[model samples]
Target: MANLQESNHQENWENLSQKTNDSLIRVRKVLTLSRIILIVFLVLLVFLFLPWRQTIPGRGTVTALRPQDRPQTVQNQIGGRIERWYVSEGQEVKKGDTILLISEISQPYFDPELPQRLQEQLQAKQSSEAAARQKMRATEAQMSALDRGLNYQLISAENKVKQSINYVKSDSADLEAVRQFYKISQQRLERYEQGYKDGLFSLTDIETRRLNVQNDNAKLIAQENKLNTSRQSLLNAQIELDNIRVKYQESVAKAQSDMGTAISGQATAQGDIAKLRNEIANIDFRLGLYVVRAPQDGYVIKTLKAGIGENIKEGESVATLQPKEPLVAAEIYVDAMDVPLIGDRSEVRLQFEGWPSVQFSGWPSVAVGTFAGRVFSIDRVSSPNGSYRVLVKQMVPVPAADEPWPVQLRQGSGVYGRVILNSVPIWYEIWRQLNGFPPSLEREPKGDGEKAK
Candidate 1:
């Protein structure tokens, strides 16, 4: 019985060892298959999806080729009511073309009053000048008449003085003759008195001689009185002559002064008329600033004030104009995370709106329907959308052998592009992304080592 039990135990142990060997073989086969499948999947992923050319993608819009190529706004320089419009929206116009007409606000017929007032002022000045001239003429005539009267009076006074002097001379000569006769009569009386005392002459003869002497004395006295009267007349005539000369001089001076004053007044009146005329001319010039004209040759993009009767203020926008020809540009925005990958003059690939495109990130040579471009500028600050702005310039298209080039892009059309960056391995990119690391960790190259300084 002991031998049989030992035999059963040995057989059971051997069966158990054989089952364990089969299970180990199955486990080894399963492990080997899993390794082979993992290797194949990794090789396929590297070959297909790993990007060989790292790029930063961005979106943008088509814009004018240059900033100055954009539309220009036209404004009214003065406030007025629109009278007429010569051009409409979208119309082509040449430089200096009349664009519109504006009329000044209506007045109550007396608001300006400048023209009527100027006319009235001019007429009044003219009338005043004429009156001044007439007064001057009257003054001159009066002066001439006074001059003639003074000349006549001066001549008469001179004649009277001459006559008085001559009379004085004649009276002096008569007085001398009377004095000689008196002396002779006194001598005769003395002779008669001596003869009477010596009885050589009669008494009657002596008395007659005495009477003659007395008569001679009386005649001498009368002659002396006449001389005095003549001297008085001469003095009076000289005084009258002096008075006439003084009066004449004073009148002449007064007349000349009055004439000068009248002439100056006339000149002032004429000056006032000239000044009024100049003011009227200035008023006329102010009325010519009501018309508006185009400042340059362009096409009207939009009309801000289109109503004919609309009132517009000074410096208000009236219309928008666009140049006849304009170049195209792309305005793109890059996210903050990808902005460090872009630089000025960086290589770019753009796909326009309405155009189909296909991109092979690893092999850009096989890209289809996409145009080449370059990054022209990048914004220093983020925009309101939290993205950095970028401007791009499109390079000339090089179409495939059997493909046609894209049509011209319109302004403000949607666009998208890729900013090509430094080349990197697919595995590294994947590892970085999985670990929440940046796309690239390498520093930018400094040009000629100058940036370090």
Candidate 2:
């Protein structure tokens, strides 16, 4: 019984000792965790409470590769097989340089027979206009002649009327003189007859006086008739003069109307000629569609892969022209969080993966030194890669009169960029005050540096 009790006591003591050691180990681990927690809390407190640099900060520089501005690509609204290439790939070109010629069917004139027909029509109109002018001139001349003749005739008729009036006056005077003679003769004859009858005069004397009286009466009657006829003739002459004057005016009015008609005809002819000329010019413009020239001076990136006699639809792209003057820029992506911090006038440092540490100093790096400039654009939308894109422009260096940037840089070169953001806002500093935690921390549980059991 004693041995049994001793053994039981010993087992109890071993169990108690094991429990004490475990308690010690647990205390040591608790202290170590407390110290670690204290250290982390101190670090976080320093960061959250620390004062930082301050200013109205603004600057973001992206690692800039040799940036290339997009090349100018020549496109066509009307497409056809390339008839001829005026320039070869990588050839230097200027503004308004003719690059390629496309062919469909070129019509120099709108109408199939327009040139000849227009020529004939123009000739006809010219001849007609000339004739109209000539006719107008002739009519005017005739009108002038008629006006002069009418004036002469009017004057002549007036003179004739005046002469007839004088004739009438002279006839009236003769008639009056005849009547006076007749009256005197009649009185003498009567006296003679009475004397003869009363035997105071001879019979022969009375007969002779009677004969004189009859002859004088006949002369007076004839003179009166002539005077009446002369008055009637004067009236007729005046009527003729008035009628001639009216007819002359009518002639002049008719001539003026004819001249107006000729002028109208000539104007109509001119309008027709202008219309035809416009049609021909339109045809020329249409024919120009068969020729495709570079829209701007650029490199030919995509060439026409069409064979001879290949059909191309209208507005189809036959080739892409990357403008030589404006270099193509690498489109670099940026993160969203970095975007707002990137202020305007952000500088970018670019490094080409293909070429690095090369001499890109001064303005010697780009062609058309004037076209090369600084970053001017940033993409408003994010890419699928969750980043924003921006365009970096290089200051183009003036070529050394002999060397250029290989007919301007080609398109789609991979580039690396580092955006430099300067003077981070007080907001970011305030975020530092929040222990680098997102503003949504209140909505989520704190990690407390441990896993949940």
lDDT of 1 by residue, 1-453 (tens): 999999999999999999999999999999999989999988877665554666777898987767666777877776779999999888998877777788776453235676887899899999999998998999999998998998899899999999999999999999999999999999988988998999999988998998999999999999999999999999999999999888888887888888888899999998998888887786676466466767677788888887888899888888887766566778888889888767677767788899998987655657887777778788889999999988887654533322322446767789988887665667776676689765674644566225422
Q: Against the true structure, what is each candidate's TM-score? A: 0.49, 0.53
TM-score of 2: 0.53
Q: Clash pairs of candidate 1?
A: 65-327
Name the regions of candidate 2 deviating beyond 4 angstroms: 1-36, 49-100, 104-124, 165-228, 272-289, 303-305, 310-317, 327-453
Error of 1 at 376 (Å): 1.5
Residue 432 C-alpha lDDT in model 1? 67
Error of 2 at 116 (Å): 6.1
In angstroms, the error of model 2 at 159 is 2.0
